[model samples]
Target: MEPDIATQNDSGQDSESGLSLRWSARLSLTTRILVVNVLAIALLAGGLFYLNNYRDRLTEERLTQARLQLTIVADALSSGDIANRDALVEQFASHLGARLRLYAPDGRKVIDSFELAEPTYQFVDPDAEPLRKDAARMLDKTIESVVFTTQIPNFSEPANDVAGAWSELETAERKSAAVSSVSYAPDRTPVIVAGKSLPDGAGSILLTANARDITRIVRAERASVLLVILVAATISILLSLFLARTIVRPIRKLAVAAVRVRMGRSDEIAIPRMPGRRDEIGQLSRALSDMSAALRHRIDATEAFAADVSHEIKNPLASLRSALEGLERVDDPDLQKQLLDVANDDVRRIDRLINDISDASRVDAELARAKFEPIDIGKMLEQLLAAREQRTSNLGVHIAFARPAKDVAKVMGDGGRLERVFGNLLDNAVSFSPEGGLVEILATPDGDEIVIHIADQGPGVAPDQREQVFQRFHSDRPDGEAFGKHSGLGLAIAKTIVEGHQGEIRILDRDGGESGACFEIRLPKAL
Candidate 1:
C-alpha cells in the first residue's frame, strides 16, 4: 500500500497529554553550587591541615634543640667555668629567643622570661607525669627523645626598687602553680629543668624542653592557612558564578526552541549552537535541525496542494455558472422541465464538488483528531440499502448487508461522515453491478481493527485499473459519463473520507472474495 500523507496537528490536547518544554531531573543551580563548594572546601582543608601539621612539628624540634643547648652550657658552667655562665646563657637566649626557657635542677631559676619563673616541661619517659608551673604548660607528659630550643633574649637583674624580690629568688626548690599557656612569646629565656646527681663527687645531669614555640607556630601557621583559603574561595565563587551563567544561557535557548516546537511554530527555532561545544547543546542543535527540515517539507507540500485545489475547483464553478445562464432562457414546458432538472443537477454537482475539495484538503486533520463514536455497521447498511432501493428498483439491482453481528455489527467512526463514505461505496457497487445481481456488505473484527468488505457480482475491474479508480476525476461509469454525470471524483472522495478517520479503504481482489470488484475498509476502533 502507498504511504498516507503524514498529518500535522496543533497542540490542543486533554490533560492526559504530557507535552511541554520543561525538562526536570535532579540537576539544578543549587545542586551545582553545593557540589562545587564542597569540593573546593575539602581540597583547601586538606592542604591547610598538612602544612599546619608540618609547622607544628618544626616548632617542636627548634624548642627541643634550645633546651639541649642550655643543658650543654650548664654542664660547662658546673664542670669548672662559672666566670662567663651568665654571658653564655645570655648569648644562647638571645640567639634562640623563640624557644627559650630557663630553670635549674630542683626547679630553681637562674633567670626567667615571658612571666615563666618556673614552667612545666614535656617528658617522654612513658611514666613521667606533668609538673605544674605558673607559666607554660606541657602538652605531652612523657619526655621527647630529643630536646630542641631557640634562645630567648638577654635579661638584666631587677634594680634596687626590686632588690627584696631578687633576694627571695631561688632560695628553695619549689614547683610553681599550674602553668597557664605555652607560646613563642618573645624575649623569653629557654625553659630548662635539669636533674643534678653526685656520685663520689662526680657529676650527672638530666634535661627537658618546653612547648611554647610549637603552640605559637601552629597558631601562626593556621592563620596563614586561613588567609590562603579565603583568597581561593573568592576566586572559586566568581568562576563558578560565571560558569553557571554560561551553562544556563544555552539551556534557556533550548527551552525557547522546544516551546516553539510544541506551539506548532516549529519553523521559528534557530538554535544558537555555540562554537566548540560538543556537549548537550550540540546534540540539541542537531535535533532541532532535523525537526525544522521535516516541518519545511510539510509546509511546501501544503502550499502546492492548496494551489492544485484552487485550480481544480475553479473549472467546476465556471461550468456551474454557464449552466445556470443557459437554464435562465428556457421557456417551452417540456424544454423548461429538462433544463430545470439539468440546472438542479448542476447545483447538486457543484455542492458535491465543493464538499469533495474540502474533504480532500482535510484528510490529514480528520486522521489526526477525528472522534470515533459507536456506530452499528449493519444498521447503517440497512439505512443505505433502504435509501438506494428507490433508485435501484427500476434497474432490478439488490444490495444486501451481509454480516456476522447482523444488525448489531457496531464500528467506531464519525457517523455522518461514515454514512457518506458507505453511501458512495453502495453507489459504486450499484453502478457496476448487473441487473438482478447482488451487492454484498461484509464486516468482521480483525484484532483492534475492523474490516468491511463491499463487493458486487458484476464485471470486476482489471488489475491495472483497480488502483486508478481512486484518483481524482477518474471514473468507472460505462456511458452516463456526461459533464456532471460522474466527475471522475467519486472513488477519490470516498477514499479521502475513509482515511481521514484513520482507516484504510482499499480496492482488494474481487475473485478472491468469490466475485466482482471488492473494496475493503480497515479502520482502527480507536488509537
Candidate 2:
C-alpha cells in the first residue's frame, strides 16, 4: 500500500516531461523586478512633471513682473503734457527702478537712461561714442562678447548671451504694438524684453531686466529633483532584489526538498526551518516540513502494517492446511471429527484476525477526520460500567466505578472513540480477574488534565512487558480462556485512539502493592 501511494503520487509528476511553460509561470521573478521598477519610475515621472510645471509658472511670473514695469514706463512717457522731456523721462525710469529706453516714430534712438547715467561708458551712445575696442572688432572670443550679447552693443553688456542673435529690427514703421519675449545674454543671464508703443503712436517704450535669478533657481531645482530620483531608483532596485532573494530562495528550497522526499532519496532530509522569520514565507516553510514528516510516518506505518498482517495470517493458514490434510487421511469417524473441529477453529481465528486488522488499518484515518467535542468522562464511565455490569452479571467478576466531581472530568475528544477505549480496557481487566474480583474505575481532574484509572484484581503485568502489552497482536491472555476469545488488538487500538486526542495511557503500579493491573488514562481538560 505504501509503495502504491508513492508510485501513484510520483508517476503523474514524472510523466510531465514536456516543458510547456507559460509566460506567467516562467516569469515570476522577472515580473517582480519589473513591477517594482515601474512603480519607482512612475513616481519619478510625476515629480519631473511637477518640476516642469513649476518652472513654467515661475518663468511666467517673472515675465509678468517685467510687463508691469514696462507698462508703467510707457504710460508715464505718453502722459498728456510734459516739460524738460529728457529730465522728466529720466526721472520716470529711475523711479520705476528699471532700464528704460524710448524710440521715436522714425526708429531713431530717443531718451536713453543708461547713456544718461553712465556717460563714461565707452559704448554708452554708439553714434556719439566710438565702440569699445573689443566690441568694434566683433570677435567670437572676448570677455563681454562670450558672456553677454554682442548684438545691441550700445546697451550695457548683459550678464549672459542668448543661444543665437535676435531677429533684426526690420519694419520699423510697421505698427503700434506692445510685444514681450525672453532671451539669454552672452553671460547666460536670462533677460525679459518688453516693448509697448506709446498712446497715439507718438513713440515706443522698451524695458529690459536681468531674469537670471529666477532662471538659475529653476535650473538648480530641476537638477536636484533628477539627482534624487536617480538615487531613489537605484536604491529601490537593490532593495527589490534583496526582497526577491529572501522570498524566492526559500520557496525554491522547499520545492527541492519536497521532490527529494517524493523521489525516495531520503525520509529525514533536512528542511530549512527559518525560525527567526515570522513572515508568511516562514510559515509556509514550516508547514511544508510538517507535512513531509507526516507523510513519511504514514508511509512507514502502512508498510509495517502490511508485513505484520502477512505474518499473522500465515499461522492460521498453516493450521488449516494441516487440518485438511489430516482429515483426508484419517480413517476413523472420531478422528475425522477432531480434524474438522481443528479446521473450524482455524477458520474462526482467521476471520477474527482479518476483521481486527481491517479496523486497525482504518483507525488512524478515521481519527484524523473525526470531529471532537467536550465529553464528561464521569458520565461516560457511568454508562460504560452499567453496560459492563449487565453483560458480566452472570460472570463471577463484578465491576465498580467512582464518579468524578462536577465539571472536573471534562475533556476534549470524540465521545464514541473514548467510550470504545475504556470499554476495551474494562474487558481486558475482566478477562484476567479472578472470580468475584472487583474491577475498579475512577475519574478525576489532575491539574489541567483529566485522569481515569481502571484497576482490576487480576495478575499485574510485569514491568518489562508493560509496554509490549499495547503492541499490535500482543496476546498475553491468562489461561482457561476460550480459544480465539480475544484478538489482542483491543489495547493497541485503545492506545491509538487516546493518542489521537493528544492524550496518553500507561500501565501504572497498583496502590498498596496490590496484585492487579492498573491502566491510567490522562487527557487534556477542555477549555
Candidate 3:
C-alpha cells in the first residue's frame, strides 16, 4: 500500500537517541559522582557525630558511678573502723571494690590487702615524699569536705563506729593515718585505704577501689561507637545512589531529545517535568522544537519555489522553440538564415539548461542504482578509434589506440553511456588538435580500476579552468570561435555519464608519450 518502510520505522530511530544518551551520561558522571559522594559523606558525618555523643554520655554515667564509689571508701576509711586493722581493711576492700593498705603512725605498712608498688601507684609516705604537699592537694580533690553518709551506710558507718572506738589511736596517727588507709600499688587502680589506730595504736586502716573493670568497659563503649559509624556509612551510600539516579534520568531524556531533533525525523519530543521545577532542560526542549519547525517550513518553501521556477522556464522554452520553427518556414533568404542561427543558439542554450536540471534531479537515483558489468575496454576504444579515424580523416588529425593486454585493462560500465563519453572526448580532441597531430587512446589497469587515457595533441586547458570545463554552460572558446558552435554541455554531459557508471574522469599529466592534454577515465572491474 502506502510504503513498507514508512510503516516499519519509528518516528525517530533509537540508535541516534541511544548514542546521545551514552555521551551525555558520560559527561554527567563526574558531577553525579561528586554529588553522590558528598551526600554519602554527609550521612557518615552525621552518624559519627550521633555515635560520639552517645558514647560520651555513657562514659560520663560510668565515671559518675566510679565517683560515688570513691566517695563511700573515702568516708569509711577516714574514721577509725575495727580492733584488728587488717580485718577492717579486708572488709573495706570488699565493700569499696578496691585494694586496701593500713600504715602506722611511723609510716610503716601495718596491714596490706592490695599489693602496692612504687611506679604506678605509690603508698603515700607523708614524711619521705617530696611531693607530699601536692599529693595532699590531689587527695582533697578525691575526698568530699562533708560526708553525705546515707548513700552507702553499710561500709561508711560500720567502719566509722570502729574508728570512733579507737579515739586514742586517732591521736598518734592523726586523721592522716586514717586517710592513708587508701594507698597505691604499681598499677594506677584507685585503691581505697581505710587506716586506723588499733585500740593500742598498733596500725592504721586503708581501703582501695580497683579501676581495671571500668577501663575495659570504656574501651568496649568506644568500639560500639565505631560500629555505629560504619553502619551509618553503608546507609548513606545507598541513599546517595538513589538520589543520583533520580537526578540523572531527566538529563538522560534531554540527551535523547537532542538526538531526535538532530535526526530531523520528528519535532515531537516529550520531556518529563515537575510543575514547579521548570529548569534548563524545559527551555532547551522548547527552543529545539521551534528550530525544527522553522527548518521544516523553510525546506518546504524552497522545494515549492524550485518546482515553480522549473515549470516557468519550461513554458518559455517551449514557446521559443515553436516560434523558431515558424521562422524556418519564412520565404526571405537572408532573414531566414539569420533567424535560424539565433534560434539554433537559443535551442542549444535551452538544451544546456534542460540537461543541468535533469542532472541535478536524477543525482540521487544515479548514485543509488549504479551497477557495473564486464567491458572489454581496449576493444571498445579500438572500435571507436576505427570509426572516428575514417570519419575524421579529412580533418587532418590522426587517431591512435594502444593495444592493452586482454584481461589487464578490463572495465565495468554502462556500454552505451561509456560510448557517448568517449565520443564527446573524441569530438573535443578533433576540434582542438593542430593539423596532423595525434589523438591517442591508452588503457591500463590501476588497482581495482582501469585507467583510460585519451590524449589529444592540442593546447592544454589553463590550470584553473581545467576543473570547471565540466560544468554546464562553461566554455573556453567564445561563440563562433575556432571550435564550431561549442554547446559547452558536451564535457558536462560526459562527466555525468562517467560518474553515473561509478567511474572517475580527470585530466592527467602528458609528458612521456606526447606533449598534449590527456583526459583520463577510471572505472572499476566488474565483480
Clashes of each: 30, 17, 29
Evaluated against the true structure, the overall lDDT of model 2 is 0.73
- Say which candidate scores most in TM-score: 2
Give the candidate order by descending lDDT.
2, 3, 1
Ranking by TM-score: 2, 1, 3
lDDT of 1 by residue, 381-442 (tens): 77766766755532676766665665345667788778878887777787777778888888
Q: Candidate 2, residues 1-527: lDDT per residue as tens digits?
A: 34422322345563443653444444777466767686977667466556545655776787777766776667766773555667766666566555566776665667777777743112122245345523422322332343443333222442432211112122222434445666655443456666666777676666666665664575577568768888888787777778778877777787777777777877668567779879998898888778888788779877987888888889889989999998879899998999899899999999999888888888888999999998999988888777766776416787777888777799988999999899889889888899889888888888999989999988899999999999888889888987676777999999999999999999988999999999999999999
Give each model a TM-score.
Answer: 0.50, 0.75, 0.40
User: How well does model 3 score by local distance difference test?
Assistant: 0.58
Q: Give the TM-score of candidate 2.
A: 0.75
Task: Specify the highest-lDDT model's number.
Answer: 2
Tally clashing residue pairs in candidate 2. Answer: 17
For model 3, the stretches where C-alpha displacement exceeds 4 angstroms are 1-333, 352-364, 387-396, 478-484, 497-502, 512-515
Q: Per-residue lDDT for 523 in model 1? A: 75
How well does model 1 score by local distance difference test? 0.58
Across 1-527, the per-residue lDDT of candidate 3 in tens digits comes to 33312212466545455345544454455466666666666665454344334534544454455445534544555555546545655665565555555555564655555543222323434455466445533432332223221121112223433434333235425643333222222232233333334335444443334344433454465456557666766666666666556556655665666555556575354333434446665566566556656666656645853664466456547756766887868888887777777667667656656665565456435655756567888887778778766776427878777899776777766676678789889888877788788888888887888888888888777678789888654667623453325545678778878777778888866878556688999888765
